[model samples]
Target: MRKIDLLFAEYGESHQNPTNKFIHWICVPLIFWFILGFISLIPSAHVAVLYYGLISVVSIAAIAVVSLYYLKLS
Candidate 1:
């Protein structure tokens, strides 16, 4: 089988437990929000060309990268 197929099979097995899946539904968003809150606490800095502060730039980059990854998988 191809690499992507193998990866999906493995991921499927890992998430088969209902309790584990439930915890993932809750914890994943909580952790993501926690990380973003922490990032927001960091002192903001001005970027010369972008005009956006550091946190905004980092958040946008992260969202773009994750979106691209999901698009590729789908």
Candidate 2:
């Protein structure tokens, strides 16, 4: 099996129970959003020359790191 398929199959194994599936379906996205919002509470810094570079925004950094992790997994 491909890496993505294997990853998804492993994920499926964990969610086999109905109650576990229900809770994960409801809570997982909420938890992800909550973490993003929590990190966004921190202030961002301006990069004078770039005009659009709001650097040091913790939420964006967190998302970037998460994306990298997903990439590695895939």
| TM-score of each model, paired residue for residue | 0.63, 0.62
| Per-residue accuracy of model 2 over 5-26 as CA lDDT, tens digit each | 8889999888899999899989
Error of 2 at 11 (Å): 5.6
TM-score of 1: 0.63
Name the 10 consecutive residues with the lowest summed lDDT in model 2: 46-55
- CA lDDT of each prediction against the hidden true structure: 0.75, 0.80
* Tens digits of per-residue lDDT for model 1, 1-74: 88998998998899999999999999999998887777655656524455553445565556678789989988
* Model 2: how far residue 6 lies from native, Å: 10
Clash count per candidate: 0, 0
For candidate 2, the clash count comes to 0
